[model samples]
Target: MNTFCLEVSGPFACFTRPEMKVERVSYDVITPSAARSVFEAILWKPQIRWRITRIEVLNPIRWINLRRNEVGAVVSTRNVQQAMNAGSGYLGLDIEDERQQRAGLFLRDAAYRLHAELALSPKANDPLVKYAEMFSRRATKGQCVNQPYLGCREFAADFRLVAASAAERPAIDETRDLGWMLHDLDFTYPCAPQPRFFRAEMKNGVILVPDFETGEVKS
Candidate 1:
């Protein structure tokens, strides 16, 4: 029952994990609390439990008014053939090009919708509030009850995990695993160290936070 916080901002979009095949994408503007809850829905925990308690938007919520860029409509030849294949299951590369292009158009439209919603709101000065309002509006407009498109300006996630047993936990230096890589140069060495945030536990779930500051990790 522990709670976490997430803050999101800047040209943000949410997509299901690559492994989860899905249809009918939706969109939403949400608060940290709501975001956390949604995140846990996709990622959850038993040994390491976390929930989103609150969320704050850091940038102006601009609803993207996106139209299909003609360039995007051209599905790769490979994708078209695969879409017609029978063994590809739900996710066939054939639809990738087309789906990707359609996604781009949807994002553009969603961004414009967000911006328009915020423009009419009196609290537009507060980017977080504006984004939340926009999300709520989209969620309602899209009639997306379980899932919706999520776009935020800047998003932060505050989380907690079960503290390792103080005694069993070794000193930081001694705890180093070969998984951590010091640098690209180190990759040439015997073994690369893993990230400090890497977790060995199987029960933990990840929260999706907007990378507004970094401008990386697109939806």
Candidate 2:
């Protein structure tokens, strides 16, 4: 397996807990799915899949409260489809009328080191040397198809390739259980998405991720 490490940091992040539907509440640390998204932002293809193995918390967990103005309603998809088909009616959302203020609890001064492995699907052309080198080159050059964010687009993440030997030591030392956290979403059946979760624990600032297929994941 070809593995890689990346150092990612941001001023603010909110990996919103699914259970918290009204107000935004973030996880103590980065989730496996969020870490995988960062990698995918750097380099992604249908043939190549990135699997997160571990997340090392490089900074102490801190929380901050913030209030943001957000629109409450979404533009109806039916309206959008009707406009696309018949070119009539309003399909845009009016923020001034629907805007609402909401409170959010987010992680402040967050930093994490991600470790992941790459797997090639049957559609891959050159499984070993092709995509691996492409990802390494893109990461070193700070090239991402889109700007990577911690959880929200407003909080941008800075990423760079880090050697395993030179990786920074995690600042946290105590062991704590983070309870059940989101692992990733299963999109195999696109019509019906499935949410998967696993028990999360942090030991010496490292959160080990279980295999998506074999691990103790609940949907």
Candidate 3:
């Protein structure tokens, strides 16, 4: 399998815990899904899927508290469909009426090195080298389909491509258990999406990600 590496850094990040409904709380480190998203932002194709293999934490984990005004409600899907069909029903969120101040705990001055491999689907026709070169070229030129974020769109991430051998190792030496962290959401059955989680442990500032298929993920 052909693998790639990227170094990502940001001023702040918030990998929000789904279990925390009221207050936004982030995981100690970046999740596998978030790492994969960073790669996809640089290069993604329907026929190719990016799988995160490991995350090297280059900065010590630190937390900061922030409070921001957010809208309480999202645009209703039913209302959107009604508007599309008959040009009726409210489709916009009333921030004045649904504004709420929420507290968020986010990572401060975060930096990580992400390692991932490309898995070609059956529909893929191009050779692996073609896609790999494309990604490398794009990344070197600072090109992305969209600005990659650190869990949240408001927090933009800086990314650069690096050789797998030259990638930086973790800066910390402590072994800490991160508890159960979100792996990704399974959407094979679209109507009922399944959330998967795995036990996370950071050893020597490196968080090793397991295979999605064989990894022990609890729904």
Candidate 4:
């Protein structure tokens, strides 16, 4: 089976059931890229192929934010162990739960843009931004304004994924606002969600990445 790996680094936290309090927690993970892609397509398209295998954390634990508004505080976990400890802080939740919920933010954001890009203009180079703007409008409903966090240090995640056969993935519908879907996701913050990713290959391998360019360009 074709597979890819995803690396995501950022603060992770869990919200109180229905409270959604932003917490300070950080972590990192490397897992099957297919799984990451599938998680990305979660609310957007169920027809997509990709399943998470395992998730490994890499970093130190730390608390960052505790906001509860449109731009909730962004936090990062020191490492997997810290995240696990935070997860354990909760009664029935585990470390993986925290990671899933934290990942939900990125997944929702990416999925929303992916949907808009295919619907409005698949040819657009920056579909994610376009979709994010669209959601910002709707986010005003619950006083939760969808603020743009592109390059915003406050809310950012460093993640990578591996996948195969992009053709197998289904296109997203533009007529929908995936922001709400993300908002509805169980990992709305403070609530630990089950992990959907895991480790793939331990050691890194060298690759001769090709620099193919038919046209010559001047710097």
| lDDT leaderboard ranking | 2, 3, 1, 4
lDDT of each: 0.29, 0.91, 0.88, 0.28
Q: Candidate 1 on 1-219: residue-level lDDT in tens?
A: 122222222244542222234322323233222343443333333322222221222333234433232222454667656766855534333445544433331122111111111122232344444444434444334333233225322222222221222222221121212221111111223476321111111111112332222332222
The number of clashing residue pairs in model 4 is 42
lDDT of 3 by residue, 69-140 (tens): 888998888888888899666777777999999999999999988889987878899898888888888989
What TM-score, over all chains together, does every model reach? 0.26, 0.95, 0.94, 0.26
Clashing pairs in 3: none
lDDT of 4 by residue, 130-181 (tens): 4443333333232222322212334444332323223333322222111110
User: Is 3 or 4 the stronger prediction by lDDT?
Assistant: 3
TM-score winner among the candidates? 2
Show model 1 residue runs off by greater than 4 Å: 14-28, 31-34, 37-44, 68-92, 96-219
Badly placed stretches (over 4 Å) of model 3 are: 87-90, 164-170
The candidate that wins on lDDT is 2
